[model samples]
Target: MSTVGAQSRGVLRAACRQVGLPDEGAQPIRIAGNAIWRLPGGIVARIGRPDGREIAERELAVARWLTDSGVRTVRPAIADGPVLVDGRPVTFWDELAPHRPGTAADVARLLKQMHQLTPPASLTLPPLEPLTKPTRRIAEAGLLTTDDRRWLQDHVGQLAADFAGLPAGLPAGLPLCALHGDAWDGNVAVDADGTAYLLDLENTCYGPPEWDLVSTAVKHLTTATVTAAAYEDFCSTYGMDVTSWPGYPVLAGIRELRMVTFALQIADEHPHARAEAQHRVDCLRGRKGPRPWTWTAVP
Candidate 1:
C-alpha cells in the first residue's frame, strides 16, 4: 500500500473503534476526496478530511431529508450523527448490495424527481457556489507550478465575473429547488433489482436545475466522455436540453474549470490525473481544442 493508503487505513480502523464498529474484514472501496470502506455487517464507512466536518454534517442531514421525502438515495446507518475520529469526520451508511452501474438516463430521471420537489422549510441548503471547491483545489495542488496556479487563479476570477451575469440569461419555468449538486452517471448506482439510487449527497444544495444538467451536457459536448446518443437520452428523459439555453456557455465553462481543478488536486498521486490535468489546463488556455481532450478518472 502507498503511504497515504496505509495512513487512511489506520484512520479508518480508529474511526471504526470510536463508533463501536469492528474494523476486521473492512475493505477499501474508494479513495479520492474521501476514503470509503465497506465494513462488516452491511455498513459502509466514509472518512473525510479534518476540514470536511461541515460537509459530513450536511450529507447526513441531506440523507435524512431525502429518505423522509421518499427520494431514492443511500441511507445513513446511524441516526445520531456523524462521528469525529482522529479529527476526521466519519459517516456510516447501509452498504448497498452488489449492483450494476447506472446509465445517464437513470441520472436524468432521478435528477428530474429531485428537481420537482421543494425542500422542507427546515432544510437550509446553501446556494450553488461553483468556484469555491475548484479555487481551493487550485490553491492546494502541491504539484502545480507557481505560474500554473496563478493562471488558474486568474481564470477563476474571470469565470466568477461571467457567472454573476448568467442568471439574467437563464431560462425560466423550472422553479429553483434542491439540486443534486454533483449529478452525473458516476454518482448514480443501481441496486440488484435495477432500481437506481443517488449516492454522494455531500454536494446536495438549493440551486438552479441547470447546475445539475450542465454536468452531463458538458461531458458530452465539451469532454466527449459521454456519447452524443447518451446525452440526447439524458435530455429526453429529463425533458430539458440545457445546452440549448443561452446561459449554457457560462455554466459549461465553470464545469470545465471544476473538472480541471478536480483532477489537478490529485495529480501528485496518480500519473493519469497529472497528465489529464495538464491537458485540461492547456485546453482551457486555448492551446488545444476541447473536443479531443479526455480526462481520466483516477484509479
Candidate 2:
C-alpha cells in the first residue's frame, strides 16, 4: 500500500499545477494519517486509495452539494474522472481561507443556515448520492467490538421509542440541512480574518435538520463548554425556535454510536482520540452517567 504521505505528495503536486498554485513540489503542511493532506497554497487535498474510492466519491458529492447551500468548503471538481495519481485516486481542492478562533458565532450562524437547507431526496439515489452502508463500513473497518456492534443494533433499534416524547409542533419538518457528516475540529479551518470553513464532508447524509445539531455538539462536548453554550445561542439567532427540533437528543444516540465505530477503527493509530470516542459512547450508553434519553427506566 502506498503510504498516505506518498500519495498526498502526488495529489498536491498535480493539484497545485491544476489550480494555478505554485507546484515547487508543494511541501506537506500536514498529513491526515489516512485519506488527507493540508498542503501549500492553503489547499486541503483529499486522497483516495483504491480501497478509499467510496470515501473519495462520497466526499466529492457531499461537499459539492453542501457548497451550493453557501457552506464554505473546498469544492471538489473531478481530476480526470477518477484517474490515478501515484496509483491512488485523487481529488483537488480550491484553497479556502482559515477559520479563526472567537468565531463561534460565525460557526453557529453558518451551521444554522446549512441546516435549514433541505437535502434533495435524489441525493440518496445515485450520480449525486451514492449510498454506502455506513454500519457495514464501521463494522468491516474494524472499529467496534462484537459487544459494541450488538449494543448498537439494539440501541438504534429503539430509535422510534427514542423520539417518543419530543414536544409536538416543535420544528417538525424544517428542511434537512446539508451536514459535514464528519464534523470533528481538525477538519475545520479558520482564515487569517477568522472565517470558518468546513473540510472533509465525506459523510453527508440527509435527515431531520436536527442531525446537524448532534454533529456540531458531540466534539465540543469533550472540550468546550463555552463553545457548546454558544452553539445553543445560534438557534435563536438563526430564527429557529429552540423547542422546534425534537430529534436532537435522540439523534445524538445514533451519532454517538457512529463515533464509537470510528474510534474502534482508529484505536491503534489514534489512541487518545479513540479513547474520547469510547468515553462519549459510554456516556450515551448510560454506562458513565444518566442516559439522558432514558428519562425513566427502560420499559
Candidate 3:
C-alpha cells in the first residue's frame, strides 16, 4: 500500500472502532481526495481530510435530501452523520450492489433530474464557488515552483473575474437549481437492472445547471476521456450542449485549471505523479499546442 493508503487505513480502523463497525475485512476502493473503504456488512466508509467535518455532514444531508426528493441515489448507512477520528471525518454508506460505471446517458439523465428539483428552504445549499478547491490546492501544492504558482494564481484570478461577469445568470439563460457538483459518468453507478444511482455527494450544491454539464464537455473536448459520440448522447439526454454556450470557454478554462491544480496536489504526496503533474502544468502554460492534450489519471 502507498503511504496515503496506509495512513488512511489506520484512520479507518480507528474510525470503525469508534463507530462500532468491524474493520478486519475493510477493502480500499479509492485513496484520492478521500479514502473510500468497503467495510464488511455491505457498508462503505469514506474518510475525508482532517478538516472535512462540514463536507461530510453536508454529504450525508444531501443523500437524505435526494432520497426524500424521489431521486435514486446512494443512501447513507444506519449510523450517525460523521464521527471524527484523529481529526478526519468518517461517514458510512450502504454499498451498491453489482454495479458498473454509469454511461454518459446515465449521467445526463440523472443530472437533468437533479437540476430540476428545488432544494428545501431548510437545506441551504451553498452557492457554487469554483475557486475554493483549486486556489487552495495551488497554495498547498509544494511541488510547484514560484513562477508556476504565480502564473496559476493569475490565471485563476482572471477566470474568476470572467465567471462573475457573465452576461446572464451562469451560461446566459438558465434557471439555477441544486447541482450534482461533480456530475460525470464516474460519479454515477449503474446497477444490474440499469438503474442509475448518484454517488460522491461531496460537491453537491446550489448552482447553474451548466456547471454540471461542463464536466462531460471537458471530458469530450479537452481531455478526450469521453468519445464524441458519447458526448453527443450526453448533450441530447440533458437537452443542452453546454459547449455551445457563450460562457463555456470560461467555465471550461476553470475546470481545466482545477484539474491541473489537482494533479499538482497529488504529485506533492506521490513521487510517481510528479512528471505527469509537471506535464499538465506545461500544457496549461501553453508549452503544449492546444486543447485535446492527453492527460493520464493520477492515483
Candidate 4:
C-alpha cells in the first residue's frame, strides 16, 4: 500500500477499535476526501479529516433525517459516530452488499422524490454553495500554472456572481427544495431486490431541483460518459429537460469547472489523471473545443 493508504488503514483500524467493533479483515472501499472501509460484520466506516467534524455531523444528521423521511438511503450503523477518534471524525454505516450501481433513470427517480419533500425544520441545512469545492481544489492544486490558477480563480468569481443572480432568470414555477448536491448515477446503489438507494449525503443542501438534474444532462450533452438513451430515460423519468432550462448554462459551467478542478487537485497523487486534467483546463480556457474531451476520476 502507498503511504497515505497505509495511514488511512491505520486510522480505520483504530476507529473500529474505538467503536468496539472488530477491526480485522477490513477492506478499503474508497480513498477520496474521506477514507472508507468496509469493516467486518456488514459495517462500513467513513473516516473524515480532522477538521471535517462539522461535515461529518451534518452528514449523520442528514442520514437520520432521510431514514425517518422514508427515503431509500444508506442507513447508519449501530454506533455513536461521527465519533471523534484521533481528532478525526469516524462515522459508521450499514454495508449494502449484493448490490449493483443504479442506472441514470434510477437517479432521476430518487432525486424527483427528494425534490418533492420539504426538508425537516430542525435540520438547519445550508444553502448550496457551488463554488466552494472547486475553489478549494484549485487553490490546493500543485500542477497548475500561475496563469491557469488565476484563470480558475476568475472563473470561480464569475460563477459566484452568476449563481447569485440565478433566481431572477430561473424558469417560472421551478420548485426549490433540498438537493442531493452531487446526485449522479454513480452515487445511486441498487440492492438485490432492485431497490435503488441514495448514497453520499454529505453534500445535501437546499437548491433548485435543476442542480441535481444537470449531471446526467451534462454527461450526455458535453461528455460521452453517459449514453444518449440513458440520458433520454433520465429526462423522461424526471419529467424535465435541464439542458433546455434558462439557467442551464450557468449550472453546467459551474459543474464543468468543478469537474476540472477536482481532476487537477489529485493529479500529483494520481499521475494518470494529469493529462485528462490538463485537457479539461485547455477546453475550459477555449484553447480546444469542449466536445470529445474525456474526463475520468482518479484511479
State which candidate has the highest TM-score.
Answer: 3
Backbone clashes in candidate 1 total 0
Residue 260 lDDT in candidate 2: 54
Kindly give the stretch of ten consecutive residues in candidate 4 with the minimal lDDT sum: 290-299
Candidate 4 residue pairs in backbone clash: none
The segments of candidate 3 whose C-alpha lies over 4 angstroms from its true place after superposition are 167-173
**How does each model score on lDDT?**
0.86, 0.54, 0.89, 0.85
Find the 10 residues in a row with the least total lDDT in model 1: 290-299
48-157, model 1: which lDDT tens digit per residue?
88778888999988888887878889999987777887778899999888877788899999998888888888778999899999999998888777888899999899
Whichever of 2 and 4 has more lDDT, that candidate is: 4
lDDT of 4 by residue, 1-299 (tens): 76567888888878777778998888888876678888878999888877788888888888888878888998889535577777888899999977888999999999988888887778888888988989888998988999999999999999999899998787877767989999988899998899999999888999788899988887887777889899889999989989899899999999889888878876766666798888889989988875755666664
- Each candidate's clash count: 0, 10, 0, 0
Q: lDDT by residue for model 3 over 1-299, one digit each (tens)?
A: 99899999999999888878899978999888889999989999999988889888989998998899888998989547799988899999999998999999999999988888888887878889988999999999988999999999999999999989874645444788898888888899999999999999999888778889999999998999999899999989989999888888998998899889889888887889999999999999999988899999987
Candidate 3 clashes between residue pairs 3 or more apart in a chain or in different chains? none
Task: Assess every candidate by TM-score.
Answer: 0.95, 0.66, 0.97, 0.95
Native-referenced Cα lDDT, model 3 = 0.89
TM-score of 3: 0.97
Quote model 2's TM-score: 0.66
Window of ten residues with lowest summed lDDT in model 2: 290-299
How big is the positional error of residue 78 in model 1, measured in Å on the Cα after superposition? 0.9
Assess candidate 1 and give its TM-score to the true structure. 0.95
